[model samples]
Target: MLPFAIGALRAIVEMLGLCLLGMGAMALLAGAGRQGNPVYRLFELITRAPRQLVARLLPGRERPLLAGVLCFLLLFLLWLALAAWRAALA
Candidate 1:
């Protein structure tokens, strides 16, 4: 029971982190589209690192919506994996 509680807590924390990361990425991408300023570029570089890595491995053009869906899928998978790990440990 204690192990289950701990696992749930860990999963919640991880979900929050992933949500924040996804939101930050979206914000940076939004900034990248703005005209007449380079400030967004810095954020774009930071947030784009993961997407760039994915793109490199996947090797394809991805639409914004598709990217968003992928993020959601990845987060969901992470949550599921964590939950499964917790259950197994218990």
Candidate 2:
């Protein structure tokens, strides 16, 4: 059960990181029109929570892209840590 929970958490972290990366790519591909793109919106929706958390952490900062990048790095680190933990358990 513990390993199962760790695996689930790791999966969620990986998904969010991918969403952040996809959002960055979509933003680049669509330019200023990314807001209207359904795929971009979907990625944004999935990553909204982390962006919001980053926003709250850095009040008055208007750089959401930077926040998204930070979130991606943090999630990546977390995923790595979870993998290590699962390996130790095994």
Candidate 3:
């Protein structure tokens, strides 16, 4: 049961990290006008969940992109720690 939960969390963390990377790429290549378009909107939607989570975690920060980066780092660290622990347990 514990291993299952850890695996699930690791999967989620990986997904979030990948989404953030995609968001970053979209930000770099996509124009401001394209934000309303479907591709950009999809990236925005994927990134929004982590942004909202980050916003709640860091209330004082005004920059959402920075917060999202921090959020991705946080999840990555969690995933790494969990992987280590699971390996140690095994």
User: Model 3: which residue pairs collide?
Assistant: none
| Tens-digit per-residue lDDT, 22-44, candidate 2 | 99898888899999999899989
**Candidate 2 Cα errors over 4 Å, as ranges:** none
- Better candidate number, 1 or 2, judged by lDDT: 2
Misplaced by over 4 Å in model 3 are: 59-61
> Candidate 1, residues 12-69: lDDT per residue as tens digits?
6465446546555656666645434454445344446545544555546666445545
The weakest ten consecutive residues by lDDT in model 3 span: 31-40
Strongest candidate by TM-score: 2
Question: What's every prediction's RMSD, in angstroms?
Answer: 5.9, 1.0, 2.0
RMSD of 3: 2.0
**What's the C-alpha lDDT at position 14 in model 1?**
65
Cα lDDT tens digits for candidate 3, 33-82: 65766876786777687788788888676887779789889878988999
Best by lDDT: 2
Selected candidate, larger lDDT, 1 vs 3: 3
Per-residue lDDT, model 3, residue 49, is: 75
Worst 10 residues of 2 by lDDT: 54-63
Count of backbone clashes, every candidate in sequence: 0, 0, 0
User: Each prediction's TM-score against the native?
Assistant: 0.43, 0.94, 0.80
